[model samples]
Target: MAAAGVSLGATVLCLLAWAGLAAADRVYIHPFHLLVYSKSSCEQLEKSSAETPKALTFTPVPIQAKTSPVDEEALREQLALATEKLQEDDRMRAAKVGMMLNFLGFHMYRMLSESCSTASGTVLSPTTLFGTLASLYLGALDPTASRLQAFLGVPGEDQGCTSRLDGHKVLSALHTIQGLLVAQGGAGGQSTLLLSTVLGLFTAPGLRLKQPFVRGLAPFAPVTLPRSLDLSTDPDLAAEKINRFMQAVTGWKMDRPVSGVSPDSTLLFNTYVHFQGKLKGFSLLPGLQDFWVDNATSVSVPMISGTGTFQHWSDAQNNLSLTRVPLSKNACLLLVQPHGASDLQQVEALTFQHNFLTWLKNLSPRAIRLTMPQLTLRASYDLQDLLAQAKLPTLLGAEANLGKISEDNLRVGKVLNSILLELKADEGEQPTESAPQPDGPLEVTLSRPFLFAIYEQDSTALHFLGRVANPLSTV
Candidate 1:
């Protein structure tokens, strides 16, 4: 009986030991516990263990215990504080950007103006005068009526001071500048700088002929004319003289006006030529002729056949056909023409076809196309070329003083630089809290580059002028 009792106790002890070992293995030798276990059996034990209940699948039962609710007012206050901080940061960033843009623009304008002035002086040099003259003559031969009228005297009894040769050249320069602004795709400030530069050139004495000579005499001195020659009777001589003058001024063969209405019919229609000569002391030559030509044209054409008028437009399809004819081998000219049509679409199409439009679609106001027979043409020119041609004489002789030109250039440059700096500074300055933001995913900061242009709402007459953030430095 004693031996049997001892055997039973030993068996119970062995069973308890086995159970304890199993429990320990389950608790401490789990897959996640292998690192803490002894290397001898931990890895094998972990591999044999069952996977634990995933936390994602373990939904807790609701507890009866009560908890405090979040404070809505306090949460709102915290959010407001965070928003304010974000806004402050944005404001600082904006201000800095604005200042930098303004500075850059101003300096760029100054540089362009200075360079233009310097170029004007150099182009007017005696060595360069002949080339300049050649360019102007070639430019006059362009098919566009507005350009032709600008270079040559307007034909009519109403011809006044504006019809004078000098006045025509000035107008041509202005038109040229307008075209250039359109072609170059820049802010109106560039055009303004160009305008100012040309005006300065006009005032410079180097451009004006010092000795007054007969207009038609120098070229045709060998050919004698009858004292009382009738213009109608001497059509040949008149034509020859006109041809010589044109050749001397511009180096291209002159095409006689086609016997139909002038191709510049739109430009000349109901147009009044206004003349304002120099204002006393301001005159380059004391009675130097100043002419202002203004006109309005209206046309009604079939919708399918596009018809309208615009100062400038672009043509993507006919890019190769578009060409830049020099106003002078050395000068600049301004040219303007009126475009008209029954509606916007037709006019735009025509302008596009002719390559008169600027690349900037947003800034383009309108397009003009005229229907004259089978031909369609767009009016365009280089402002600098026009000015160079008009101011060609100024580049010649001792009168082409570098110091005066440099001073003028610097003054213009400073003004442009200041403007740019102010604009950039404004951009850099933080926006006030009171300033409202636009409600859109695409926010347009007023600080971004912008362009402005003027248009006569009733007509295709577009005068583009404005500031841009960063004008590329290609020019």
Candidate 2:
């Protein structure tokens, strides 16, 4: 009897080990890696799956929206033709990436600036906005993923699995941009910069998000707080809760309370970015200076003055002049002002042209006196609203599979991105008395509504885009 019992126990142990081995053969790829497409990555994915790749598919019901269906086929073909001229090898290079990012930056800047022109100034972090969209791409399935790829301007004519947009590459490039800022902000750098970014994911109470999806946000933000809140309970209370939570975490207050949360919503994505840049040789003057909000209106705002040899360009044809001011070894600030006869709207519209930003490369150095208002600007807007205005309200709507975000169907509510920008001018070491005086260096004064962008010097990667309509207005 003892021998028979031992034999049965041994048989059970053998069966258990075999079952474990079979389970181990079925590898689970994180949703973050699903969008990573490469020949070797594809091979690895195939080897990990015990069954066909289709077996690993996760398709959820699309979050419903009240809008007309978009022509996906037409959009895809248009994008293909637009990028057909570029050589395949140049598609994902640094230059192309810069242009692609600028393209998206100009689009978002236009939407935000135009909407806020009547009310207040507009400021946006293009890198942060791009990362927000890329995070969603990680949770999207094809058709939805393809649409995002087209919007992202990922180089490639084919949108198949083998040639899918590489989320990893996009995130990596964004990370590089952030790293440049950090290096430029280090101690003893040419300028003093403080940049803080945080992403908040608020979900319905008791809702569970995919662990992999939450972890995938690491590349985009150092801190991503995912919390459960009953958003529908009381809109006012919900806003307070989020505001208090963000304040406690980052110590920065939102200029306005978050709104547009829906009772039926399942998730609200919000990102807060705070940026402060102080020029080394620029110093704030004591009294307020006149900043023309328009032809007839003017406001007294704190002003900063500096004298330096800066790169300048006057585009008489476009009725705008640009000045490139160094912020650090790897970053510079582009200040663009329209000619007196031209309005901000006209100059802004011209930015949509393909070669508009290339003007940065054509600037010539000239010694000059520069004065501008000290800027403390804040801008807050929802991405969904922008999409609605852009006539693609159904882009993230129902029929879009977001299975990777959550097993339970998710109805995304409002995706908000906010910015708080503070630009100060500091007095550096006093100029030497023996230095040669320029022969009437041109004087450039930004006393009116103007556009500004912070860019990585080498790559020309746009970090921030904004329009200062009123130096006194921050919203």
lDDT of 2 by residue, 1-475 (tens): 2332242333334323432343455684322222348678768767776653432322222222122323323322332233325443333343444545666777767767667553366777778787888888888777777767666644224554566767666665565555455343335433356666677888877666776677777656656777777778786777777777776666675687587578778788898877777776888989888888877888999998888778889988888888888776567888988896245778767743344667867898777788998888877888887766655676676666777687676888888888888888868643212224556667789998888888876456788877788887766
lDDT of 1 by residue, 1-475 (tens): 2332242334334323532353554453221111112354435545654553221211111121222332323322332232223334233322222222222222222323334421111011111111122223222222222232222212212223222223222222322322222221123211111110100011111112111111211121111111111123344553344334323422322233111222111100000000111111110112212111112322221111121222233343432111111111111111111221122223223332222324323232222221111111111122233334333222221232222122221100000000010011111212112223254121111111222222212112232212221222111
Candidate 1: segments with Cα more than 4 A from true spot? 1-442, 445-472
TM-score of each: 0.18, 0.79
- lDDT (Cα, 0-100) at 192 in candidate 1: 13
Q: How big is the positional error of residue 68 in model 2, measured in Å on the Cα after superposition?
A: 44
Q: Show how many residue pairs clash in every candidate, following the order shown.
A: 68, 2
